[model samples]
Target: MAARNWKKGSFTGLHGLESALGLFYTRHMFRLAHFSDIHLGPLPAISYRELASKRITGYINWQRNRRLNLDHGIIDRITDDMLAAAPHHIALTGDLVNLALREEIERARLWLESLGPGEKVSVVPGNHDAYVPGALARCRRAWADYMTGDDGRAPTGRTAFPYLRVRDRVALIGVSSARATAPFMASGHFSKAQAKRLGALLDRTAAGGLFRVVMIHHPPVRGATHAAKRLYGIGRFQKIIRKHGAELILHGHTHKPTVHRIEGQNGMSVPVVGVAAAGQALGSAKPPAHYNLFEIEGEPGAWQIRFSRRGITDPHGEIGEVSGALLSPGK
Candidate 1:
């Protein structure tokens, strides 16, 4: 039960979360789990063939890629373990598919469905989820019974962006940064309207004392190494965070386990955390398929984030804690 040694104010490039932490106000406490890049099974060989036939598939060279590491049993086990920890809620960033295949999307839905019911799980779509014209909508349709009941009804027809999942003490702000890239670009961009809407949503939610946890597919900031500088419009995303405060930011595009502090305009540091791929066989020091468990406590407006690493088995295994963040404290 010992906590992992965490620096008081540190930022992980989980997503380019740059919130300026001004005065040190009282800290709120909350716990939740974060995982990303599921890349569910029954992958399309055609997509691989298509990638192979072509020189490249956006930023990734799939021709050289060897495998799709989404193990169903492993994922299920991890979910079971995380649930045993009894987190407040779960946040899935994106990349829930190897390709936007119908079967894959259906399988993904089943997988998420097997998890806790509506009040327990929140998810967003990644580029692969929305690669096709209406791929995202299809996935949403399949999971509608299991996921939140947004009903895909927005003022606009685009259900791809600005989805909400509200639990007991947390509100998951699911944003769609998934966009089909043209050959060499693997980056994503949220349209001006989407960004504006997201900012406004955060503002409203924050004012209402909701713990807003923003989830997206791409990294909001640059990678630890400059090798992946293809960061698109991350600066704008950071500005949105500054405009509105968030408790924790979670993402999984880069697949590297990193933690960072986003500085809010108010000079308060916001904690952004990332998890390595929960997909099977990622070839990392830790298990190829691992998920993060957060121990959250506190009332609405005030919550804390404590990070824990969980493997496929050993649900209650104490891997250790990383860092914690305070959102809004209930008066």
Candidate 2:
């Protein structure tokens, strides 16, 4: 444990004068399981292709003709394994449904509720959570039932971004970038109001002398391989984070694993992590789906983020390491 001052109360316009519970002075180190894109639903079909029927690869096409059942048991199994690891916290980045059905949202709630107590699990709404246009509100309402608070609205006025988990020496800040848009377009965007509020919150949380984690459903940086039409307001989003000294940013809209480096508000390199969807099975061209386990260690303002994967244990399973800028704390 390092000897340092852990100040309670707000020191800035963000959380100034606010009372905060302090943990005994010690090194804050814990493991976090970051998983996203569960797409849990009343998803009853041989495949997602039959419902809305999107263009799938030739392999999935063959699999669909085979009439295999879409067993979501895999999701439950993965969740069980992740919880069994006893991570300090679980960060789910959203898209827990195939479509935004009321039943789907309800089912997602039940799934999240079954995870554990609210404090141990933190979730952010993804684009699919908004079943219909402006469904984010509904998604927020549904998940609030699982969290401990007043209607799940954060002081920032966004229900998805509320509730700072002040456990150990880490403050996990949750955000929502999920929105309903026209068909054929799947992307996420952070409103100007939300971005500003997030910056203020990050500033206050960082000043509190705890490791600051910013969680969202969309990638903060533009993905090189992402379609231009599907890109979110990631540029402006990253600008706010860089300006606010966010150490770790977690997201999971893109199914494939993505990690990027963006300049932080404090001139430091912030690591933006994107976890693959733990829900989707290997359709055709891709490997089996998996989740991420991140172990962070070090003193305040200086920590190392180590990333690993779980789910597929087969000798030839599609598990690998996250190297380069993504593996290191500072890109």
Candidate 3:
């Protein structure tokens, strides 16, 4: 009996050591599929009653302007191609619906279900997701599962902002910048409370040696979008980053593909990336509908992000590789 117990203890110790070595010596690789600004169309028929508020302007704009610019079929094609690539996890930045109507919010929930389970996909909201006063509240309840962290803990009061989800070696931090704006405005904001919490989250996580990826709807940098749609408290975000730093930042709202770098701790250049509208047509003034596939390799602080930009070409309607690049953030 004594010999058997000794053998069991030895085996357990060896197993723990083996797991530690596996994490240190070998690079854990995974593909992250990112796409945003769906802006799903064929809006549910609005009632003359429903069109009384700010929704009226949005409805008219959708019917006259957006209908020609965006296409649901294009989104289908883009998603088909994205699924074929077989990503480990998917990150959907926001704007699933344009008007944030009850019908649209429910439809967006269905659309999220079609993408994959809530566990496999992480979503954040866009300005369009919270287009009206109560629309944001409606959206949060519907997408609560997708928006919350995987920590399995219930919130004390309001659902907290800047939640964290860990997958393997990656830590995906979700930030909410979506806010209801007045007519003709598309701005986004992050409150001081969220900013303070975010700094603590980043500092503690970065110290623990996990690759931190920030998922927010609005870009956290100046000149990234028009003044009307710009993300406020960008300075606050940058300050936090300069002190603690994140490995990557992903956002969507501009319906444009953009790549940028912001200051990071120890003088590293953190990559801030954005994708074009996932449901936008091929040649609608905006970039073609597309998705970003990031192939992450190596360990935290020494990681390499290889990105493949897949997109559709206008007039031809052919899906092809739009661009590819090797990203060494903080290098």
How do the candidates rank by lDDT, highest first? 3, 2, 1
What would you estimate as the lDDT of candidate 1?
Answer: 0.63
Residues 297-323 of candidate 2: C-alpha lDDT, one tens digit per residue: 776556777777776554344333433
Cα lDDT computed for each candidate against the true fold = 0.63, 0.66, 0.84
Worst 10 residues of 1 by lDDT: 15-24
Worst 10-residue stretch by lDDT in candidate 3? 1-10
Top candidate when judged by TM-score against the true structure: 3
Error of 1 at 280 (Å): 3.7
Between candidates 2 and 3, the lDDT winner = 3
Give the candidates in order of TM-score, highest first. 3, 2, 1
Which model, 2 or 3, shows the larger TM-score? 3
lDDT of 3: 0.84
> How well is each residue in 221-241 modelled by candidate 3, as lDDT tens digits?
899988989999999889888
- Name the candidate that leads on lDDT: 3
